[model samples]
Target: MIALTLRQRNIIEYLLSRDSYVTNDVIASNFEVSNRTVRKDLEVISAYLKEQGISLVRKPGKGVWIEDKQEVLFDDLSCSYSKNERIVIYVTSLLLNDVNTFMTLASNCGVSKQTVINDLNTIEKFLDGYHLSLIKNQGVGTSLEGDETDIRRLFIDLLFTNDHSKIVYELCINNDGIQRNLDVSFELITVIENEFRFRYVDRDRISIVLSFLLNRLGLMKTKNSTIQSSDMERINSILSTKISDSNDQEYISSFLLGERVEGSLTLDSKVEDEANEISEHLISSLKKIHYFDSEDMKDIIRSLTVHVRAAIYRCRNNIHIRNELDEQVRFAIGVMYEFTKKELNVYETKYNLNFDQSEISYIALYLASIFETGVQEDLKVVIMIVCTFGLATSSILKSRMYQIFGDCFIVGPYSIEEAEKYLESHEVDLIISTNYMSVKSTNVIYINPLLKQNDIEMIRNTLFQESFMKMCSLFFNKNKVVEHDYHCLGEYISKNDVSISKGKISWEDAIRKAAAPLVAKGDIENKYVNTMIQAVNEFGTYMVITPKVAYVHAGKDDGVNKNCVSLLLLENEIPFGSFNTKPVIAIVVLGICDKEESQLLNIANILDIPENIELLKNSKNIESILSLHD
Candidate 1:
């Protein structure tokens, strides 16, 4: 008897999996071994194969291959499965089929009981991800423990790893349970698709049919799974099979009903009923949460009805949306996001449903779009420029301010005495003077006669602060006006608001380091950092708004002590998620105050400019970064 080591088996398996010859270097690299070791391994395998009338050929540049003309020897070797792969398959079979005993798994997988026990350790790790466990009891032998929905989702994920083609092939290809009945299911799908004038993704169509067949064959279990009586009768007539059990019709019925909503294509009775019910509750919840316009209430309700229907279908099926604009949308519509999530929570509680953050983010995106259309124009910042450098210089400064701020501010050039007189009568948001002024109002910024990039940043900060104060007054405090010294990006950067991460770090660590300066300054608490990280874990890299930049922020309610922004630059780029092609190099942690809100549009606008983004990514000094606005 011959015993093969795991490495030898892996080497042979790797070579066999490939159609062309594999280089010793590639094989060694894959297994993390030296090329010499790989060559030695090949030599040992070659010596053994020669005795069995098999040839191992090694071309100079092409690499190594097996040339067994009879194909008998290699075919035997191909049947050998890795212990780990066998374990996964064995556990999957146990979870899905009637094979529950340790003995059955061992026999089915051609492994020893001890080997199966060792494999269980690895299997436990895999099941832990789905919050599931593999338990072996004296009476029951072995069983899986988890929510039925989560367990099924885990099974599907393990089976197909997001590949729908493999799902169809595994469940429907020449299988005894579905081999005959699939034709009837196919006909049913065609009839339904045509009658409803709705299309189903081929993958989803096959899965629906497969779910029905598997449920019927007793290979899979669907908890509380059912179909309408009318649908059941129609399906039974089409198949001419007496589906005596009501449960037998449920899986197909739910799938069909879900498919109609998932596509958002058909407005049939079933979809309409589900959509209206969910949308009415959602809209009512939103209205209760905040004051909004009722002018386009019907249109808004209709849009929500269709969206919620689709969202419900997806949530149940564990389908996720990959929203690229999630971070930007969340940042821009900060309060609205919280409002939308709270409203969705109402629906979740009522229906016993779970909506992932991505779904909530999608809803927020739609709401933000609708809300933006009705945004009341901002009250322009009124500035009275007091220039010590006479009329010509003051006029130039005023013109430049107007050029830069555009509609954001109303700039007026005035002498120091004239500014005092104007301020006595008119309410000015800010005072920009060439020389230092002993003004009564604290809202004053001093800049040089020649406005530089740094000057624009300062002016932007002043205006942003004023806008934030207004928002705070409107939202939280209506009595006293909120006041705070305006801090520009340059001041923050120069005041050591930046943390440069040197080596490879996790996204969580990157965020923590980015926000550490603010945390140290009592701008935000530790809980806020954890909350931001948790949000990323739940919703993915929706925070990565642009390449090399991530606005890592959670809701204001999540431990925000004050409104602040800190920047962290990474020397080594780290991958965020599917959203960015380039790895993230900058993490801008935004700590938003619960009582006060800042307009992210200005920040977004500055970062939106490619040149500004480039400067932020490449610059090491505050001066270079400020030059971006110029």
Candidate 2:
């Protein structure tokens, strides 16, 4: 089936949502896109609808509307959407298949050959980042040229891209190499859960099941195939006649045990000696940073030992488990996440690997449990679940919700009438329903009853906003809120502007140049610059906050004239010692004469956004940079 782009799907939904036909110009303005872009999106949408035996009528003045409204068709398009995701999945499928010609791939993906070629170029770049390559021979067609483990890693990554569970289940049931008669993937998942005696998270289960199916498809293999006597016995009890091959049993058992043998997979070792060794290092590193307490030493060690063991295995094999909570974790945890990431770098470098956001998030998840109560305690937003399909489904969803959200919500499953009555008497922060209900509430969010990852993300984002608002209300005066320290980037730049460094410079020289702006602005004396340089020379470039951005600041005691901030965009990337791979593209200097007037935290928060950092780097003038604040 042809997948629609997010914009195309959104356009269709917009048209469907409205009774009257809206003009193209209106939509273009609404979406902040050119009229040409809107027209093109509509054309794609209209063509897609036409293929489904529906007509999208367009009147020049009145705009566009569907002739026969088909919510089911639109819903299907929405479900199977996302252009980048489709391209990634299509390229992955082509890489695994026998035929790899652009024509054949395009035909399979239901796109033009040119589009397939373009996607291949994008795929090539993506593979390069993973230290893999896409090679196209004169007659042998195209292939993914990479280490066997990396190839398998790519497969798992692609499989878990969009609507992972739904897509994986279909792949397992329909793939020619896998058994079509039985739901082998689902059954294997159940067997693993039973043998392991621990429930895998929804996404993790999908990844595991898909990995098995991919193995059955002869595209991948499990690393370790060593099955213990006890594990083998348990597997036999669970599978019995379900799995016939002894090798298959061993392979599945090894995967469950998390032993690294070959294919990209997480290895779990229960060896107490190794566990103690890893736990000792983990605890020691965390203690040096004072990230956690020694009170729960045994439990922390045990938990982290297992986790780190699996993580080391994953790193060695290049298997990265996607963390759905990565963005939320980073946004909420902020400096804590950064600190955790930095501390974990010791292990990462030892393993000769770079930890993805997902892996860092796992670490944050560990620490957040320790120090999160202060922020997380009062953030529970009451959630009412409305699902007509019995209590079993609701109970399952409730359990999953709690698993993902922790104590962030007070969720209750309610019938439609029960929900209405409850809402009438009590306050509900949000309503999560399978089907659209005519509820007079602005906080109603429609989600799949199955609780898909995308649905979870949508719900998470909503709750995040709600929690942020609640936090703000609690801290700030509701009516007379404190204003932002600075109006915009332009204002900051104009007030405390610095010259961009010319030519390549040392990290020390760069800081000196960066501080010149503060000195010129009279924000700080020349002594402050010397203090910052000396501090960096002594302690190193810990001021390098995010990628391409660094904040250079010394304590008010060091040397300070007033509380102000200045920006310095470097013409060339400057390496700051052996700190990190990230080059210092923009240097934000802080002058803190007094701690009370310092907006260092707010400045860091603003620059934390990657796009804004890009703006700061690329801006020819302050006016251009300020445009981003809009």
Instruction: State each model's C-alpha RMSD to the native.
Output: 17.2, 16.5
Q: What clash pairs does model 2 have?
A: 223-261, 223-262, 224-261, 258-267, 258-268
Question: Candidates' TM-scores?
Answer: 0.43, 0.46
Candidate 1 least-lDDT 10 residues: 475-484
Any runs in candidate 1 off by more than 4 Å, and if so which? 1-88, 100-113, 122-184, 187-191, 197-199, 203-242, 260-265, 268-310, 316-498, 501-566, 570-585, 588-606, 609-630
Stretches > 4 Å off in candidate 2: 1-86, 100-104, 117-150, 161-174, 179-182, 203-306, 346-354, 374-630
- What's the count of clashing pairs in each model shown? 2, 5
lDDT of 2 by residue, 1-630 (tens): 556775677777888888877766567646645456777788888778877888888774467778778544654783343456546656556544644787766755556788777676677777886678777788778777765556544556655433343444454445454444235656666666655655554534454444444454333344343324564567556654565555455544444444311222222354454434555664565444334455655554456556665555455444556565564454445344555665576655564655566666776676545443434555567777888778789888888888887756555787788787788778877788887777754368777777875567557756765654444333222111333444456544454364566688887777777787667767788788887765554333345545566667765556787787777777777766322123578777778664334554455555655567677777676556554441
